[model samples]
Target chain A: MPAVIADGLVKSFGDTEALRGVSFEIERASVLCVLGPNGAGKTTAVRILTTLLRPDAGRAVVDGIDVVADPRGARARIGLTGQYAAVDERLTGFENLQLVGRLFHMRTAQARSRARELLERFSLTDAGDRAVKGYSGGMRRRLDIAMSLIADPSVLFLDEPTTGLDPRSRLQMWDVIDGLVADGTTLLLTTQYLDEAERLADDIVVIDNGSVIARGTATQLKSASGGDRVEVTVSDRDDVDRVPVVLAGSLQAGVEPVLDHAARQATLPMSSTDHVVPRVVRSLDEAGIDVVDVVVRRPTLDDVFLQLTGHRAENDTDADDDDSTSAAVPEGAAR
Target chain B: MTATATPTRSGPVPSDRHVVPTGATWLARDTWTEATRHLTATRRNPELLVFATIQPIMFVVLFVYVFGGAIQIPGFASYEQFVVPGIFAQTIVFGSAFTGIGIAEDMSKGFIDRLRSLPMYPSAVLLGRTFSDLLRNIFTFFIMLIVGLFVGFRLEGGLVDAALATLLLLAFAYAFSWIQALIGLSVKSVETANSAGFMWMFPLTFISSAFVDPSTMPGWLQPVAEHNPFTIVTNATRALYNGYDPGMDVVWSLVWAAGITVVFAALSFRKFTSNSK
Candidate 1:
């Protein structure tokens, strides 16, 4: 049976329809990632399902409890972590968790022991006694997630859990989420990062303007839209021609090799990169092509989204790039 | 802190570890939990605790010394004795504004949303807030008493009467505090809540017989002051603490307290449980 089911959920704020007939379901113990840009009803859907906001129209059930009819009952079976870290800044991390446990109706001793155990599990034991305001963003996020688990909720809704974090912290949070999946917790996450959804989700639901646009496994979505492309960076600008030439014969039929002189790079589009990659590298080495880098660039979520939405995933970003331009991320993440 | 408990797919929930007590048990437990959070915050921020005592002490000293020489009352022994109950009323009304400001701040901080998402009692937030503020008031009342003693303010009645007066004062303050909770929940910003709280409270306290007998006021304001709840409370408190005439005003004061609590607590609880804000 599905752990979560939302049929025809609808909500509005004044004139703005935040959600319009939104619907989806998630199997037990599996991860379903809700993908959408900011203000695309991702948070609204999560809020409705977690019993924080009541929908104007629809029926939602979690762990067999109706969200509309019995929100308090549904709340008992679900844990929610919002985009913002919702833990109190004035209280110590341990105090925050202890209060939540007590609110969950645990005995004093049980609450304390559970608080201690969670702090340790989240690697917050050393800093648990310190006020949450003094914690780093990553530590606060971890604590926020830890607080949600105090009652062992059957379903967890994490809305943009790693947003605004440095890449390193994002990786750390991902590892923690991965562990939750391993423990068989049904996870429902919402994020704008296609890579995050692709990496973490068992299934992905794409929503835009309060409606589901597409839904599928990450690999299937990628294959249905476009296949992988191989990126090769030649050390010498003059050898860029040899780069594509050596890769041409190994490429599949109907697939063409493209060369970029400015960046001294070559790209080959293919149905699959597994067999063609080794052949291209061997042929390049045989030709003394002097390659700086060789990477299999699977069609990014950006491409799949463009294929589906008829526009790039980001509203302001351009669609075209050198077939395999590396994501030009800044050196260090500021937030 | 995402992990509350590991999800168990099938079975009766563990009675000892994960039982979610409902109704009154849930309310009492959650209110106590939230109250402890507020108390812990106060301990972590000693400045707030110090200010709670210092503000009341300052009020008692300033009124008894600087203003005492200028004011006179016909029947009382001294102006300090006459104004002590008055000042107590003003201090508590002022303290009640914290209820509004605290809720506004919590709403702005997204803390209320988190609490609402939980399986806890709906009105526990307001109860916890009042609980903590009540504790703060009790502590400050003692500080004011010590300061009152040092400034020629005497206890002219029995010890039990003094205790009863304190409880009565707190009861009125708690009722007033619920109105502030309503204001706080209705406002958007904490700044607006704080400013609006004091703006309305100032007239209610000052227009009453808190610092001066209503008889000394202008003809029109005198009648208004005579019937004001603050005037009623101060008169009841003065009678209980100073061995004065125990008129129907004491009964009226309790009625006012109960009336304010029932109307405002119901309104505040309704606003709190609604989906708005």
Candidate 2:
């Protein structure tokens, strides 16, 4: 069985449906990256998987344990690090780990030894005796992750682990995650950073409006949407109106020039390099049209998201908040 | 679904045992840690330590010396004897408000969220807090006991009765801390929990027979004053101090303590779990 399986998951908070029929699977020992904007059912999904919240409908299994029926069993096997660091401010870094160890039923001496080991592993041995309130944000986050691993849970859920960290700190956190993956831990990470997902996830699941809009490897999703995109910038604003006439014959039967007058650029969709760019350049040259620049680029995750959902990933604040809610995309748009 | 897939050795395999630490044990350890930490922090700030210790002492002196002259109890030999135990109960009960205020501070600082995420026993949050407050109450009780002894108050009851009296007072105070825990968990702000906890406590203390004999009160208010939990506890403590057998009131006070602990614990647990959801 897969390490994690969620089927027909539906959740609603009062009048708002946070998740609607969301489903996915994470293979054992693989990193499954859940990507979406804020308010995307990412946090909600994490909460349910962690046994912190119960879904109103649908069933989920973690490590072959039913989440709803055997939540405690599931909880025992899973580790969760929420968006905010949950370390005790009053306890020193060592004490926080010790406390968690004790809670996990380890003997006092065992807990102490484990605490020391973790303190050293997280590079917090020097500050182990100091109160967490004295630690920096990055240090606290590291400690929070250490606390979660005290029990050595099989499944790990990290919700926006690097949301507020600096680039350096973010990279540091990524390295820690990489280390965990190397240890054969099944990780389910929720992130808004496309690069983070592309670099870390073995499989990517894109959720919008509380539903899985797209799911596949990064290359597969991008290629499925369109392999290549050619953008043309006109030399003059007045020349933008002539784009359609200039490239009319070279364009594919279904391909249309998307003119953005304000930006003085026109985008042409193409399946492959082939003769499309050459044909367009020949046609524009024959019309005495001066082209500033023309470039072909592979489809990014953002483009796939925009094409499949009809909304830019970053600018859609609504998708950010209601990440699990299904977006009302325009009909006949890029799937 | 591939049923025969080998159980991979990637991450640590968690146990099937659904073990959760008991509420009492979890709270005892966590609260001790937190209380000691708070005490350490307070110890560093001499001003805070001075104020925390002095405020209860001031209450002891003001109530026994200043108010003793103006009041008289029909059966009691001296007002000092009657007022000292009352003040002890009042001071400890009032101190219980810190449980809620401390929780509020933790909530505001996001410390409560951190605690919630841990696999620790769920009740540990409130239990550790209340237990810590109970320790502080014990210290406050002793300080007042010494002050009471200096002011001509004597424990008529033998060592056992005196010990029982102390235990009863601490139990009641500990129970009251749970009430504060509920408030801390529900209130919007730590300052609000501070004021609101004290506001509610003042009336509970005043309405009881903490200050004077229930017989001395008007006929209309007699029943409430008689049945109030604080009344039973104070009367039991006074009886113990005066060397008189407290009889049924002691048992009733214990019952009240146990009942309140269970009820408030359940309520706080419900509030905590729901908030996380």
Q: What is the C-alpha lDDT profile of model 1 across B1-277, one tens digit per residue?
A: 4434432333323353434556675677788888888888877787777777888888988998888999888888998888988888788778888889888988887788888888788789899998888887887788888888899888898788888888889999899899999999999999999898999788898999889889989999999998898899999898888878758878888899999999999999989878532
Best by DockQ: 1
- What is candidate 2's CAPRI-style docking category based on DockQ? acceptable
Evaluate residue A242 in candidate 1 and report its C-alpha lDDT on the 0 to 100 scale: 77
TM-score of every candidate? 0.86, 0.78
lDDT of 2 by residue, A40-145 (tens): 7998888888777789899889989888887656766787888888777766898788777665655566567778877887889999999887998889889988
C-alpha positional error of residue A255 in candidate 1 after TM-score superposition, expressed in Å: 13
Q: Which candidate ranks first by lDDT, i.e. highest?
A: 1
Clashes of each: 22, 14
Off by over 4 Å in 1: A224-302, A312-335, B1-19, B218-220
- TM-score for chain A in each prediction: 0.84, 0.78
- Top of the candidates by TM-score: 1
